[model samples]
Target: MLFLPAFLTLLGSVSAVDIWLNFQTTNCRGSGSVLCPGLEPNTCCSVPGRTGNPYTSVTVMHIPSVWNLDCRGHAGNYCGPIRELQTSNGRNTVCLGRGPFGGGGYGFWNGRVAATAESAAEGNCTRPSIVSLGDGTQYDVADLNDDDFNEMILLLTSSFHSFDIVEADGISDDVPEKFNINKLDEASLLPRYY
Candidate 1:
């Protein structure tokens, strides 16, 4: 299954709020360096350029995997790690690193590999893979190839202002482990929908 890590940081026009779930992130520890301190477990940093060593600055994130990735006989049925990424100019996209700074990917999709994928055993793979959510929404998934699940999922929305990526908390028989995508706040819709 594809797991959206239990944490997300939203820095928007409104405010900066860091939300955390009990899940662990994978970006730190053993990329040719001693494990950095104060990082969320499994999390590592991402940068647009190499102004400094990666283990020093930048924020790390959990990247989504290429679940159904298929390559020729050279590789198949593997979930590769994303190896590079950075925030887009407008914060609208999380793109793969490139140019004098250097990023992975042989060519370009949208002028850069939107995400990077590599199997420890196999080779490279392309991205922006299509997925249909259980809630009936379709998504275009991209990985930054930064060695984690720090990819982007593009969803068509009526408005950017109303769009939210929500992580629900607590467990109740009244509420399902599987979230209802239609209700970002779950109970916020009761009076109107029920």
Candidate 2:
């Protein structure tokens, strides 16, 4: 949600204090690199304050799989352990390393992967493929919107990389509509991942 502060003045010139309220934020880790650390990955992360502001505006976070306990058949699901990233400017170059030269040593999301499907020969399909939690497939966290909330975009990267958006409510109750990537809009009423 976007918080637009209202101004209360007598003559449109006298203002005492400007209050910034209800800015969406995530408290993810930082990697202190020249790259856009965890700006737009399959998860959410916290971006530290830059040279201009005293508070940060961005963060990183992850969504547990709705299909399984661990991430299976999902590559690039891990958010942390990110080595380097690249972006473009007018004509200059920026690079973030592992040193203290303005490079943050923050960490990103690092999660465990799900176990492989059991072999039929070994025994029965004791571990059921489909569980109560929406068929035990496994989903990764991603940001569908850039508005910046802790909302989770469930990702299923298998033969094809498909995604769904779900507002996790802690326990397995009231699982909302699955997040669809094609339906994402910059100004849509849906929450932003920025």
Candidate 3:
């Protein structure tokens, strides 16, 4: 009986996720390191003492897996709009931003983030679907996973934003090649907004 309880505890710890938020940019190097640990999947948790503070970078650590993170603004709850969605598999350091493209570009969440929700990825796969969610002025696909697809999709929207996912029989040649930010050069630490 003792062994069973200990084993279960160990198993639970293995599935937990640890995320680090920093006040500095470029590889999360700076003071005020806030660690949000043991994060459960699909659950929103507020970062203690971090609300209303300017956070510039983030680092997520998960044992035996990868996960997705949704940083929310306004309050320490999931009900608020998502400010940013980042993956743990790539870069290790994700630079926070104010908003979508033409907002602040990157390197500044600036007291906008209040809470976070984590979604663990199945296996070691990465999300590849990027869609444009624009009204008419801007056509940028930077938002991640507006619709759940077992993986995160970059969704870019403008004035009127909406999207949907469907199964396709085959790939279309006209479809441009998917872009993966993880594959970018190591020197490029900041995410580009266009």
Question: By lDDT, who's the top model here?
Answer: 3
Per-residue accuracy of model 3 over 111-141 as CA lDDT, tens digit each: 3233212221112111122221111111122
**Best of the candidates, TM-score:** 3
Query: Which consecutive 10 residues in model 3 have the weakest lDDT in total?
Result: 100-109
Q: Please provide TM-scores, in order, for all candidate models, with all chains considered together.
A: 0.17, 0.16, 0.33
TM-score of 2: 0.16
Q: Rank all candidate structures by their lDDT, best first, as comma-separated numbers.
A: 3, 1, 2
Model 2, span 71-108: residue lDDT tens: 11111112222233322122111222221111111211
Our tally of clashes for model 2 stands at: 24
Better of 1 and 2 by TM-score: 1
Model 2 gets an lDDT of: 0.19
Candidate 2 deviant stretches above 4 angstroms: 1-77, 90-156, 161-194
lDDT of 3 at 8: 42
- For all candidates in order, the CA lDDT equals 0.21, 0.19, 0.30
Report how far off residue 130 is in candidate 1 (Å).
Answer: 1.5
Residue 87: error of model 2 in Å? 3.6
- CA error at residue 86 for candidate 2, angstroms: 1.2
